[model samples]
Target chain A: MRPLDWVVLSGTLAFIVLYGLYKGRGSNTISKYLLAGKTMPWYAMALSIMATQASAITFISTTGQGYVDGMRFVQFYFGLPIAMIVISSTSVRLFHRANVYTAYEYLEKRFDAKTRTLASIVFLMQRGLSVGVSLYAPAIVLSVILGWPDRLTTLGMGVLITIYTVTGGIKAVTWTDVQQMLIIFAGLFVAFFMIIHLLPPGISFTDAVYLAGAIGKLKAVDAKFDLANRYNLWSGLIGGTFLALSYFGCDQSQVQRYLTGKSIAQSKLSLLFTAMAKIPMQFFILFVGAMVFVFFIFVRPPLLFQPIAMRDLESSQVQPRYAPISAQFDRAFDERREAALGLVDARRAHDGGRRAQWLGQYRQAQARINQARAEGAGVVQQIHGEKEFNDTNYIFLSFVTRYLPAGVVGLVIAVIFAAAMSSSSGEVNSLATVTVIDIYRRHIRQDAPDRHYLWASRVSTAFWAAYAVFFAQYAKNLGSLVEAVNVVGSLFYGTLLGVFVLAFAFRRVTGTAAFIGMLAGESAILATALFTRITFLWFNVIGCAVVIVTGLLISWLRPVRQPVAA
Target chain B: MINSTFMPTHRAEMPDEPPPILGSWSRIYVLVLVYLALLIALSYGFTRYFS
Candidate 1:
């Protein structure tokens, strides 16, 4: 990283931390610490929600996904608006009227304590496992790009976020999220326009779009319906709806964001705004990736985007295997670059026949390029002894550091750090909130003073931060960090969603039925994940369905009993 | 369960008011869903045009 980049990165992070600390000053009570005292405006909460969900992994890995896999990943968000509409109507009012700190806390108000406990444990487990990867995913890429140690990067980010989040609490987390999100928006705009500007001479923006489309990188929607197909419209609408319901409706990280809102209307507005905004934001990011793919069509990219993997590939032990793949990759790059130029020239010449001829050659060369890259990844995987691996996470970063100028490079890196802190801060804060509100106060010490729980929340915040950093140190290749994080959530989120569904939708389902329903839902998800070829997105659908059906069946069989008032 | 001090005493009565726009919350929700359908349509257009 250059001196200008360092200045931008450090200066931006310092300002955000200080600003968060300033905004978070008055969080002395349990409510204030966890929910921001219900003082947050809809705009602030909306941005915080976006920032928290748009983790560093989302920012970095998603662009790389666009470059490698086309824009199909965007279909995954088609269900978000539907989910938001569902949430705005149901969960928003229910959660607001209940005046709960965490979403799981509402479970106790509706069902028995065991059901609430089960939901809380599931959230803690899912968020805990995924939170560390949120930090680690970007750190690994930044380490490769900037030559910094991944461990030090994770530790430094963890410490910087902890200072504000632990001190200022959710207030600190939310306001800084607002700031970070604005800056992230600015960074994305800069990166998008700058990448387009860096495209080859004589290639106008329209021509660049044509090139990306010609290679199928611009295929954003697949309308076909297949259960195993992960990103088609059907799964996105159906399975994506379930996953979004689970994440926003049930998870504490998201629930805590809205729980801080000024009122039900404000919180509802926040979610609806997010639903509207998230898709365009994601499509733009993927478009930026598609543009990066176009950028590399003219400018040569390394055979392996990750530097460490590249070095290991060329080491003495692996060089013999790596040489053939390297030669193949180099040849493919030359052919692909030539065919791209030919296609562009044909477009400028307005010759449809020549365009088609060039397009065919362009696709053939592209296939060869993809094949060479796959072989290169195999060599690296064999060298590292990892089960499955790719450098898809490194594509965007490698493009930025190599091509973008100094100040913007720093800004992009700052955007990354800001995203990491924003996302991890929310996670750590919610993890602590659940630890204190759902588990500690409810089960362990029901009569504790607000002052006592306040201290426990602080202590718990520090503990989760420590745990995230420690886990990040060990987090390695999980393919694309964005998909890995979501997959991990799906494992547990389905059952969490099921419990909430029982609370809100099925009025007569008993607490025992709900509790047992959770077990069935989770077991079904686990079995589906282990024994079937179904994609991760369907896990939410399967689990929620199983939970609801089981709960209904059990409720019918059991004798009627007076339920405890929540 | 009898400890009142365990809860926050500063706030009470979470009131749900009508949305500032569209005259009501349900209207606002319909607008959002309509917006979503349009977005998917546009996305499909982008896909079809590009491919």
Candidate 2:
């Protein structure tokens, strides 16, 4: 909001968008417009792919996760590398050899048009449903932390994305994503070092690590196998792999990124690079969150990271019930800070006995601190009359705005906006591609001129952008919106992945069998979601299993009736 | 086999090329997997050391 912050934010955004437009300048034909003329190098596609997967909200919330929970959540990506390898070997070569514009377009070649249409519709529904939430949720969170209007945030993001996407096509989106990612890296590094430097003078980085580990913040690996436990090694490796396959293999947005690669080797390389990069990237973000937690140990954080919630707690209506909780939080904060210093001193003296006593005291104070924080949440909940409340996502946002210097603040904010735009642009672009290539050109007018479809793609991109902005405004009041969006994507990915699995892995399965199996898989996943308490990650497993079994059974009962036209 | 009449038959099938660094695609894949294993091991070590 300061003059310097404004300059940095605006300048950073303007450069990324303009750079995207410049790089995408030659996208006149449909091929270049949709697939970047199949000339993109591996690195650009790799970063673009990563950007699309990790959005603005993802960045904010991940750091917040580290502050509140711990590094255990990183296990969620254990399966990603495996999924990448699978896709690199199978879908990369097949989609390249098939020379398809979208992944669903290849389904039409392997299965029937109905199957392709269904797969495309599934992607459209899942991606289209979530894109608005992805764009708006982060903007609203930023609005709360930075005191900006949410509508304006969403509008600014939508406008910047539309300008580059419509003008330069996928080329614009990819290159701009590259810039966004690079800036995001800069912002992250700056934020990380700032947190380290801001730590209490007595605490070295080693001490900080020891302190975080003592508090269980560095528990990055959980080997215990539990079905419902979200971040265990098994679920992350198994369930995570299924979700990643659904994402990178069946999802048009990701498939389209690598399809733009100059050759199969480049496309596969892009995927492999992402496989190597994604986990470390997530670790860095979460580690930043852990550092933020360490910084707040000596310097007290607010009862809740959400400022509006804090102000609401000050209101006369809530103040009577909240005062005692506020007092308790202050007491716990002092006790925790003192205990942390004592523990540090004990460790420096190599006094194991004193370290144990101080560790116990520190954890007790931390527990009390958490309790007060919960009571604050309860008061906030009373105001909203919600079932449950969490201010987890605001931890890092509040930290960045309050502590970081002015120019750096703007850069970090721009990094967020860049993430939002990069993610949204990819989804919006892919939505348009699937629309024009899979639906409009495939069904409505198969013989439309290339120029006609090119214009259609542009028009569709604008429409989705406008639609995302409009939808984001109404999405503000919906509770658990991020989880809802994630669930929506997971709901369909399994069945979608199943159909593709049948196409590639089971060549004996007929188109009718595959199509019928998809319906069965969809129904099974929906039933599982509604009737069972199974975690959403396992939804992909169940859906894929049902589809494969059903497809095989049906194919076994039937024979080929007619030859496919060639 | 499915219908291919409307498929873009005239579009040349891009030949698969070996990775620039690894001697073969299989070798590259093994390297990536090995790298993943190494990352997991390091993360586990960090957890153990700190916790």
Candidate 3:
């Protein structure tokens, strides 16, 4: 990044932080500190919800996911809008009516103190680790680009988010999210336009699409019902729906966003805004990745995107032997480029027959090119003695650093930083809320005054922020941070969602029944996650089903226990 | 007996002051239907276009 780029980056970040601190002015009480006095409007809630969910991982890794896997990943969101509507109608109203600080509070009312404590514990563990990944995801890229240690980047990002969150609380997080989201949108649009501008003279966007399609990069949907295939339509709809429901309905990070809405209507409207906008927004982001595929079709890409992988390959020990494979990869890339260009010309001429034939040839050439890259990656694996080597996480970062103009490069990097801060801050806030409201207030100091609890919230926020930063230091070489965290959530979200659904839908099921059922459901989910190769999204379905079934069974066998008094 | 206070608010009284922030079932129904239709339509279009 150049001096001008640095100026743009620094200026954008400084403005957002200062603005957030300014809005965080009136927060003194616990409710104001944790829930922003429940005064956020629909737009802020919507953008904040999206910003929290769309971490730096979404921007950096999803684009890389797009570059490597194509647009099929967009199918994962097929269930999201539907899930949003369901949650809006049910959980959204219930939580607002209860006016509880954390979602787990309702569990205590509907089930028992033990059930609520169990649920809150699950949330704390899962969200705490997830917050760490959100912190680390952007830090990885900054560390690579700036040639700094990962620890410095992680600590820098973690501290910045923690300070503002500690100062302004939820209000700061929401207001800053509005700014971060705008920068993210601007950065995306800029990247999209620049990609179109750089395409070689003879090719139109359609031609590029057709060329990408020839090699199967345009595969947006797969109708086959394969449970193991994570991104297929059925998995996306059924599994994706459960995952989204568990996330938006039950997860505090998202619950906290809508909970801050001034009224239930505003909360529902804000959710509806997200439900309507989320899929299209994700599609556009994924499409940017697809365009990146087209961009690389005209140029050469590195064999491996990870700096460590490259470093290992470039070291004196392996460079002599790796050179031939690198040369072969170059030749393969050049051949694929020529073949793709030829197919593009054929399509442009409206020669359908020749275009089809050329497309076949082009597809074969591209596959061989991919095989060579894989073979090259395998060589790096052998040299380094670490078997797992996938550079899908690196593709977009490599493209941005090498191709994007200098000033825009800095702005985009800042956008990634803002995204990391917005999301990690939300996670930290939610984690702190759960820690203080669910654990500290409920179990440790139930008689404490509002002012004491307010101070405790700040203390918990700092503690969780420190914990997340510490965890991030150890999170190296985690393939696709977004997918890894989602997978982790899938393992638990299903059962948790199930517990909540039972809390609402099955009134007769005693707290004891639901509690026992949740335990069973959670156990089943963990077992499934461990022993099976079934996609992570399916875990939500499993968790929800097991809880419902186990809860009912337990209720039928044992006399109903009375619900705990709030 | 379960505490009366923890019981859901009386259905009759709920509508009188009807909390200003309530989700409408009718609206939710319509929204769900529309999105379901769009997903199907989009899927069909993408399949046909790709085919």
Candidate 4:
């Protein structure tokens, strides 16, 4: 990075932090600290909700997913709008009318305290583990940018976010999320246009699109009904809906965002806004990745996007084996580039025969490229002893730091840091809220004064922040940070969603029945994860179904107690 | 009927006023669902056209 880049990066971060600290002033009481005094407008909460979900990994890895796996992944969000509508019509009013500090608190009012505690603990565990991955996402940025160790970067980011979050509370998290969301949008637009402009001269936007389509990068939907397939339309609609319902309706990190809205209408509006905008936003990000893939067709990317991995492979004993693979990769890239250009020309000239020929050649060249990449990955595995070696998370960052101009590179990096901080702050803040409100205050010191609880909240925030940093120190070995975080959430979200579904839909299900059903649901999900080839998305569905069925069965089998004569 | 006392009485609160744009909350929900269906259809078309 140049001097100007550092100036822009530091300047943007400093302005955001200062603005957050300023806006977050006067959060003295627990309610003000945790919920922004329920005074946030719909737009602010909407942006905050978006920013929370769109973590640094969303930018860094999702674009890479688009490049490597095509846009079929967009189907994963097909269920999200439906989930939002359901939550808006149900949970939004439920939580707001209850005037609860956390989603789990609603569980106590709806079910028994045991169910509430069980749900709270589930959230804390899932969110706590995922928060580390969130912190690890931006740590990858600083590690790549400055060549600092990932551990040190994670530590630094954790401390910086913890300070602001513990001091200003959700007010800081929400307001700063708004600023960060704006910056993130700006960075994305700039990077998208830059990718288009950086394309080879005479390649119009339509040509670029056609080239991406030719290479299969533009396949955004798959209509197949296979359950094992992760991103098909059926999985996206059914399994994805369950996952989204668990995430938005039951997860505290998201629940807290809308809960801060001044009124029920405002909360519903915020969610509806997300439903309307999220798919298009994802399309834009994935489209950026597809463009990057096209750009690399002309400009050869490294055999592996991760520079450190490549450097290690070069110096390892497997270097001899890797050399020929690198050569073949270069040859394949050149051939693919030629085919792509020829295909574009043939299409422009309306020659179907020539177009078919070039398309055949293009697919063949792509096969060769894939073969070379597989060989390279094999060599890297030999050197690193890590079987699931993937360089996808490095693709976007490698592009930004190498290709973008100085100021813009810094802006994109700032966008990444903003995403990381926004997401981590919300997770850490929510973790603290659940710990204090659900566990500490409810179970430990029910009669404590407001000031005492507020102090405990800040302290718990720091505790969870430190824990995330500690866990992130080891999170670097995880293959894809985005998938890793989601997988962790999926492992637990099903049972949590199941319990919530029971509370909402089945009044006859007793608390004991619901609690046991939740345990059954969790066990079933675990078994599925361990012994089946089903995709992780389906875990949510399996879990919710098991919980509801078990709860109802147990409720039916139990003997009804006779009421004493009045 | 199952015991009513065991069931918690925390019913969802109804809004005093109608939604800002839509005439009612149900309409707003329907509008959102309709938008979602349109989005899915468009995405399907985009995929088929491209692939």
* Candidate closest to the true structure, highest TM-score: 2
Candidate 2 error regions (>4 Å): A561-566, B1-12
lDDT per residue for candidate 2 within A55-76, as digits (tens), equals 8889998999999899988999
TM-score each candidate: 0.95, 0.97, 0.94, 0.95
Docking class of 2: acceptable
Pairs that clash in candidate 1: A109-A566
Writing each residue's lDDT as its tens digit, candidate 1 over A179-198 gives 99999999999999998888
TM-score of 2: 0.97
Off by over 4 Å in 3: A477-484, A561-566, B1-25
Each candidate's chain A: what TM-score?
0.96, 0.98, 0.96, 0.96
RMSD each, Å: 3.5, 2.1, 2.8, 2.3
lDDT, candidate 1, at A12: 95
Writing each residue's lDDT as its tens digit, candidate 3 over A1-566 gives: 78878898989988888898998888999999999998999999999999998999778878887788877888898888888888877887778777788889988876789889999999998898798898887787778766768899889888788778899999999999999999999999998888888888877887777766666666778889987888988888888889899999999999999999888778877888888887778877887888898888787777777777788777898888678878877777787788777777776687888877767776776777777777768877797676677777677777877888988888888889889998999999999999999999899989988999999999999998999899898877665555677777777798789989888787677788878888899899999988988768888888899999998887778765665657
* lDDT tens readout by residue for model 2, B1-51: 444333333244478888999689999999999998998899999999888
What's the distance in Å from true for residue A382, model 4?
1.3
The candidate scoring highest on lDDT is 2
Clashing pairs in 3: A264-B21, A265-B21
Interface RMSD of each: 6.4, 3.9, 4.2, 3.7
Docking class of 1: acceptable
Q: Which ten residues in a row have the lowest lDDT in candidate 4 chain A?
A: A476-485
